[model samples]
Target: MNYSKKIFCQPLLWVIALFLISSGCQPKTEEQATAENRETDTESKLEPLTTENVVEVLTSYEKEHADSLVLISTRHGDIKLRLYSETPLHRANFVRLTKAGFYDQGEFYRVVKGFAVQGGDSDTRTMKNGAYKIPQEFNPKYIHKRGALAMARYGDERNPEKESSSHNFYIVQGEPKTVQELRAFEAKHNMKYTPQQIKLYTTIGGEPSLDQEYTVFGEVIEGMDVVDKISEEQVDGQNWPHTIVPHKIKTINQ
Candidate 1:
């Protein structure tokens, strides 16, 4: 009877020892799961604050407001501009700047005969002055035509490539349309225009050569006469008027 009892007790002791070993292993498993869960939570918390996420948000905003329009009031007159949906970056940049009242005190700094009128320099935004710059957004589809508004950049002399200044832009007016004139302009600039584009320029009249070279995000919608008036202004060597003409633009609904 004593031997049977000892045998039973020995097997029960082994079982108890195995149970303790298994219990100890379970704590490691639980610790590992807890660590993995913590890592997952940290990653989830860090996700949306990334730079890529911020840029995505801004890009989304630009897409939403692509077709917005703004009205430009000048001492000459008022011109309504329809911001193009195709050129999302340029459209959003312009809208953002205008809403910030960046152009409130800006003057038309550069004007040229039969070419364009330019403004939006940092020097233009002044109590005395305010300064800011935007990125260039050059789109080939939008051309410089009658009432076509585009950004102005320094000539390729220093820039070498026609890189645009974000703040400065121009309005193209009554430039003559001739094949020879087109050829001469293209040849002089070492640029090329498509046959269909050339045909459009000759008939419809535009600075087609300027397409894709500068950011053209908007066109004069209502007050093209105002653009014409400003385009016709007299200018000095710097392309600035002897009298400073103040131009103010306010954005309305698209």
Candidate 2:
């Protein structure tokens, strides 16, 4: 979080390369712990997502301040994330769902080494009953750098606006790139990267190709070693972990 204030800036089939993609435990602030407690208290009054009410529910959540942090405890390790206030819809939706215990038994079903890791499918019928979609929450301020937390969505053909899936999400764990690689990307994609972007991607690493295609509302604050470990774990043909990798995402209340 001490990095410069410079803002750097996918998809709705999320190929994830099917071949390409890719935590730590940390303490929480007193204020954050209190906020999380308040959120849990109000969870009972919140309703599940549904086709008829997805838009309305998202709108309601979008208007609220985004000041919460959450923990993604996986078999590999715990990843602490700071939700970005700029993408209010995505941030609010994530916070609300985390507080509801909707992600208790979720697994990191999709993992692409050196690319990203995805989860949030509560396979139970109860979660399916609450299945819904939310509109895209794209913003120029958020980028898909390594450790970025973004929502998963279907393809552009089926979802032109690139609306996000209500529950599924991913965290980028991309590899570093050289200026030459970045230039080639620019030539292919017809986009330019700011100097700050070039510096980050060439230094810390990230999936720059995914920028703007998906909504990135947060980033990991600690335990990135866990992310690296998970990315290197064994996976099946579909990129799912060969061994079960349990995940439990909840609001970090200290």
Candidate 3:
């Protein structure tokens, strides 16, 4: 009777051990499954926003929503800008950069009183790094008028072909210049502004001479006061602000 009991107990123990091993090797717990599903969902959502996928997204965006207006929020004030559909490259580039947090923690490095407040250098993007350069997309039709957002570039002698620097951009703040002033600028650059362009300038108040010279991709939409504050800050010889009023730019919700 003792041997018979031992035999039965031995088979039962083996059966229990096999069951434990099988359960251990089965699918993960509900908590673990949920966590894995969440991770996958996050990755899938971020895939479209990644740098690799940005270009395609921007290209499609340009065709359907060229007249989209963007609002830039700053600590000091909000600035609104209308994106130009004509300059698809510049518009797309600006959108891509903004979404990537490229303007976070950036300083208004150059501020000319009653003229413009400039920022967006790679240096402004981060304390430790400088920004990358972008190709020039100058449309003579897009002029530098009050509140106009324009790219800053090195002089043609240095930049040759008037290519724009991707990192630096400025928002015009001064009163619009007259046609005579625009003509003088055109003469200096050996270019001409068209009649249609002149009409646009007369109505819109842009510096036509600056068209095709600098890339005008956007304009100030909301926070001119914040720009004024930065423009009015005291600065050193190197254009570094003595007081260093920090600024950040965020995209407006559509």
Each candidate structure's TM-score, on Cα atoms with residue i matched to residue i, is 0.64, 0.77, 0.63
The TM-score obtained by model 2 is 0.77
The per-prediction tally of clashing pairs is: 2, 16, 12
Model 2 has a clash total of 16
Q: Candidate 2: lDDT over CA atoms? A: 0.68
**lDDT of model 2 at position 140:** 62
Q: Write the candidate numbers in order of decreasing TM-score.
A: 2, 1, 3
lDDT by candidate, in order shown: 0.56, 0.68, 0.55
- Give the clash count for model 3: 12
The parts of candidate 3 lying over 4 Å away from their true place are: 1-67, 122-132, 176-179, 190-209
RMSD of each: 28.2, 11.1, 23.9
Q: Which lDDT tens digits does candidate 2 get at residues 1-254?
A: 11111001023234434433221112233344334435554444446465578777766866763546898898788989998877777888887877666677466766777888877753331332144567888776677888999987756656677777776788899889999988887786567888998888998899877777788889999978888888887876556677767788877654
TM-score, cand. 1 vs. native:
0.64
When 2 and 3 are scored with TM-score, the better candidate is 2
Sorting all predicted structures by lDDT, with the top scorer first, yields: 2, 1, 3
Candidate 1 residue-wise lDDT at 254? 51
